[model samples]
Target: MEHLAELDKKHFIHPTSSIQQQQANGPKVIMEKGEGIYLTDINGSEYMDAMSSLWNVNIGHGQDELAEAAAEQMKQLAFSSAFSTFSHEPAIRLAEKIASIAPDGLNAVFFTSGGSESNDSAIKLTRHYWRIQDQPERRKIIGLKRAYHGVAAASTSATGIKEFQEMAGEMMTGFVHTETPYEKTADEAIHDLRQTIETEGPDTVAAVMAEPIQGAGGVLIPPDDYLRQVRALCDEYGILFIADEVITGFGRTGKMFGVENFSITPDLMTFAKGVTSGYLPLGGVIVSDHVHEMLKEKSKGTLFHGFTYSGHPTAAAVGLKNIEIIERDGLVENAREMGGQMLRAFEKVQSELDIVGDVRAKGLLGAVELVQDPATNKRFSPDQQAAPKVIDQLHERGMICRPVSFEGTDIICFAPPLIINREQVHTMVEKLHDAVFAVQKELQVKG
Candidate 1:
């Protein structure tokens, strides 16, 4: 453990981590193995993977089927470039599978290496689509506040998180952010969206991207009609809607995709993470039939944007097998059931504890907002670090989860593997209860 920690600190810069923290504490936990809904550290300490390792492992930690698929494909043909009209069977078959299962009208795909690349591709492709339609002025891409797309240049610019953009110095032009429906009523939110569109000049806008449910933004769930209204508004203005489903796709949201929960068909949808359950990095933008047709019919030479790993044979094979497992085992339905059970568990804990402000869950994704006083909705000071304290307690108790303290809100987030069962749900909640209780006692003493 010490050897690995020293190497990690000296040579590796972890993604989305505090470098100083790594220097101070080394690696938080050196994971040695993973299976079902749990992971084991190098020292043999087991932990329930409550956050699914950044909410991507929808099917769970270790699945033999995906490994076998990758191996079998690699033995036959490890890779073949899908560039300049070159193609391969794995890419073709996976694209067909994605088209068959994606939301209606989204029947075409352009592959990428992962969510960041997928989102970046979607932005470029949307602008290209408009360019083909002879609207060269349509280049602006608007994303929702608190929405997380990816870490690539375009995706980073499209993200609503201030820290992400600030870290990148100055962001690129043509990216705008608007308030989310979580902060406003559905009607008001739609009005705000329409106003943003009008202000941006509808003729100059290429697409408006959003996460159906804000996952990293504290699991903020909008009203039932919020997305539907947004879809209608976009249609009314002749602008494209892009659902950034990197976290919510592939049965994580109790459906094949998150947009289905709202019954809306985005012009373009970007996905990754659970697409292959993190076994292999693969992601793509599923284009609508009309958009695909227009690009096919009117596009000029070379659509041009692509990744070297795009349509990688092994990753594509693993993605196919991953989807097979998700369907065959009925993990999507399990996420729905387990999600409700988890929500009820959260509510029960909230009822008994005033510090738990609000509990929101959709499918296996959920969050518990921490408050100082629920009746008044008063928040604990930032110095208290209430959510992180509770999360640390959970970690000490052999459960892994995330604490979200974005924009003055303290939230504990969870997105357990879809394979999690009722007993596991109860166990997670029990540990969470104890964790929150322990933290509250510490805070009381400190106060």
Candidate 2:
């Protein structure tokens, strides 16, 4: 603990962490390793990785085969470029594999370092494709409020969470925002979206981006017909639809992609996170043939958009192998099966808790939202960190679950590894139940 505290206080700069609190109380450091769906800290504490290590780690942790694959690639060709006049076999093979798995008509791939960069690339491609089609005026990209795209400029513009933008002091141009379909009827949400488009005018709108199931936005599962309605709305408005599958891709939602889970195809899809299971940084955009062909044929100039690490060989090799493992191990099928069991467990627990507002689950992804009064459907005040307290208690009880507080609501997200089994799910629920009891006690004491 001495070494951990010293390092965290002196050197570690964490993302989305409260640095002041961290410096005062030190970090929650995991010293050693993980295997399958479990992790052991330096203090010999074993816990379930309930959030799948930030909703990645699809194939779970400590797969020696993955390590060996990465090691062998490093030995043979540690680094290479995929820029013009230079392309690698692994990159080509991975691209082909991605194209095969991606929805029909999305035949082209442009790689990036992670989800953020992939989303950024999608923004650029959307505008670029529109420009090539001689509609440079169609540059307004609409994103749902509370959506989490990424922290980069363009991607952040597509991000609707207020905290990400509050300190930035401003927003990027050409990024329009609409209400998320969460907690709203599909028809009403669609009507509101139509109104937004009318207010902005369709000619000014270029693309509309969404998550099939809002992952970072409190794991909000919309009405069943929402994505289909969004598709129809996009088609009617002549707007390209982009599915941001950063958290839901690669079998997280019990499907290879979230778009498949909802049965709605987008013109473009951005993927990252589980692609390489966070073992390597790899992400990209899958463009429809229409957009791909337009950019290839009608484009007047060079693509002029890419990263120095685009299609990094080592990452591509790892990603290719990752996809293979996901397919071979039948993790997607497992996710679907375990998801049913997990949702039932949550439902049973939900029935016992008066504070439980909503119990939503799809595939391996699920959430249990808290409220002030369930009968009245009254939510707790946004200032109440009820979910965060539960998250902290869960960690103390030897598990990791994300307490999503987007828009000041309490939704505890459960996204375990696809490799998790029924026993692990039971263990996770038991620990979460204990944590919820403890949090309720704490809230009572505070009150």
Candidate 3:
């Protein structure tokens, strides 16, 4: 373990992590094994996987079926690119399965390696569809503020998080951000969207992209009617709706996709993460029939956008098995039921702890907002590191959670595996309660 830690420090560069911290502390924890809602590190300390790793892992961890499926496919045919006219059965079946389960009209699939690539492809596909329709100028995309898209060029540009865009240095351009409906009225947010589009000129605006629930942006759920209004607005402007379901896809949101909760079918839905539960990296965009027909009939030779590992046979096979397990075991319903218990648990935490300013959940995806003054919802100063401190307390107590301390906010996010049971939900939230309580005492925040 020490040797591996040394090697990781010397050679490996972690994504979106502090290099200084990595150099100071060799490694936080080397995870060795995982089971339902539990992860055991190399030191043999077992902890609840409260954040589902990176908000994926809907099926939990160490599933034999997914491994067997991958092994079987690899032996038969490990890889064969989906480029040009060539394709394989695994890719075809997975795409078909996604279509059948997806919201209506999004029947066609274009593959990518993961969320970033999927979103990048979706942005390009939107433009490509418009270009083919002789609306080449309809290339602008409007994203919601605090929306977390992905890190690739176009995806980064589309992402509403200022930090991500700043990190990418110069944004790819043709993208604008509007205020999110989170923590506010939908009418005002919708008006902002409308105003932004009109200001950018309706014809130049190609699509409006967003996550059904802003996952990485602190699990901030919008008003119930927000997405519906956005859909109508998009339709009014003849603009495409791109749903980035990278984190909220599959059973994580108590539905196959996050948009289902809002009863909205986006024009193009980009998905990854839970499709294979992180067993392997696989993601894709599901396009509407109109978009599909446009590309099929009008597009010139070579649509010409895809990753080499796009539609990977092994990954696709695992995805099929993953969805099968989700269906057969009724994991989506499990997420819904367990998620209710978790939210109630969080509400209980908020009621009892003054530090817990707010709590919100959409299925397993949830967050507990920590604040300095609960009555005013006044946030703690940055130096306090309230969210990370609570997360550290959770870590010491044998549980893992994510901190959403971005942009002067202190939040602890949770997305336990869909397979998590009622007892596990109760226990995890109980631990979170204890952790927050401990942090409250440490920070000396008074009621």
Candidate 4:
């Protein structure tokens, strides 16, 4: 184990991690196994996976069903290119199954390796659709501020987070961003979208892409009618609406898709993460019939956008089994019930802890905002590093979650496995409360 840790430190380049910290501390916990909502590290210490391993793993872990499905497909037909009229049953079946469960009219599927590729494909498809319609100038894509798309060129440009865009140098042009609907009524937020569109010239705009609920942007849940209003506006202006469901799809939000929570249909929907419960890499975009038919009738030649592993049979087989388990175990219903329990528990913590500034939740997706002054919602100074400190305390307490510090505020977010039970929810909240209290005590001492 020590030798492996040394090798990881020497050779591995981890994503979204601090290189200095990795070189200094090496790997903190080497996870060995996972079951249900708990993970066992190499040292045999157990931790409640409160963040669901980057907000995927909806069906928990250590399920032999998904493994068996993958092995079965591998033995029969593992590798095949989903290109130039070549097709496979697993891909065909999975696409049909996804369309059956997707929001109305989004009946066509385009597979990708993961969320980033799915989003990137959506961008290219949107632009291609416009070009085919003879409106080649309609190339601009608009996104909500604080929104996370992906790391690809087009996806990064569509992302509203400035840090990501800056990391990649000058982003691809023709992408703009508008204000998020946080703390605003639906009408007010819709007005902001309209203003951006009017300012950008609707003729030049191609699509308005947004998450039904912004996950990485601190679990921001907009007003109830926010998406509906946005859909209406996009329709009115002939702009396509793309719902990035990478984090919210497949029962994470207590619904089949996040858009169902708002009863709005998107022209294009990008999904990943929970499709195979993180057991396998798989993602795709569900194209609305409107867009699909347009491509069918107007396209001159072939659609040139796709990934090599777009329709990997092994991954598709696992996705099929994952969906079956989610349905058979009634995990979606459990997410709704347990999510409510988690929110109520968070509210109780907020009432008890002055450091807890706000608590917001939707289904299993939730966040606990920490602040220096609850009375005025004043955030902790960046130098304090309050969020990471609290998260460190949580790790010591055997609960794993994410510390989100975006837009100058610190928040600890949770997205436990959908199979999590009431008792586990209570335990998670108890540990979170203790962690926050520990941070608060440290702050008081420093003062």
User: Model 3 — which ten-residue stretch has the worst lDDT?
Assistant: 438-447
Where in model 1 is the C-alpha error above 4 Å?
Answer: none
How would you encode candidate 1's per-residue C-alpha lDDT over 1-447 as one tens digit per residue? Answer: 899999999999998999999999999989999999999999999999999998899889878888889999999999999989899999999999999999878888899999999999999999999988889999999888998888789999999999889996766899999889775788887887889999999999999999999888888888999999889988998999999899999988788899889999999999999999999899999999999999989987887777899999999999999999999999999999999999999999999875888898999999999889888888899999999999889999999999988888899999999999999999999999999999888888898
Candidate number with greatest lDDT: 4
Q: Which candidate order results from sorting by lDDT in descending order? A: 4, 3, 1, 2
lDDT of each: 0.91, 0.87, 0.91, 0.92
- Report the Cα lDDT for candidate 4: 0.92
How far is 209's C-alpha from truth in model 1 (Å)? 0.4
TM-score of every prediction relative to native? 0.98, 0.97, 0.98, 0.98
Off by over 4 Å in 4: none
Going through the candidates in order, what is the number of backbone clashes in each? 0, 0, 0, 0
Give per-residue lDDT, candidate 3, residue 223.
87
lDDT of 2 by residue, 1-447 (tens): 788788778988889889898888888765488998888888888888998888899999998878888999999887887777488888899999999998888888999999999999999989888887788899898888878899988988888888887758666898878877777788878888889899998998988999888888888888878889999999987899999999999888888898897788899999999999989889999999988888879877567898988988889989999999999999999999999999999998788876778897889999998887878877878776889988889988888889888766899999999998898899888887888878777766776
- Candidate 3 lDDT by residue in tens digits, 1-447: 989999999998999998999999978889999987799999899999998898889899999999999999999999998888799999999999999999988899988889999999999999998998899999999998898889989999988888888874976889999999876799999999999999999999999999999988999998889999999999999999999999989988888789999999899999999999999999999999988988889988887787899899999999999999999999999999899999999999999997889898988999999998999989999998899998999999999999987789998999999999989998899899899889899889443
- Off by more than 4 A, model 3: 445-447
Q: What TM-score would you give candidate 3 relative to the actual structure? A: 0.98
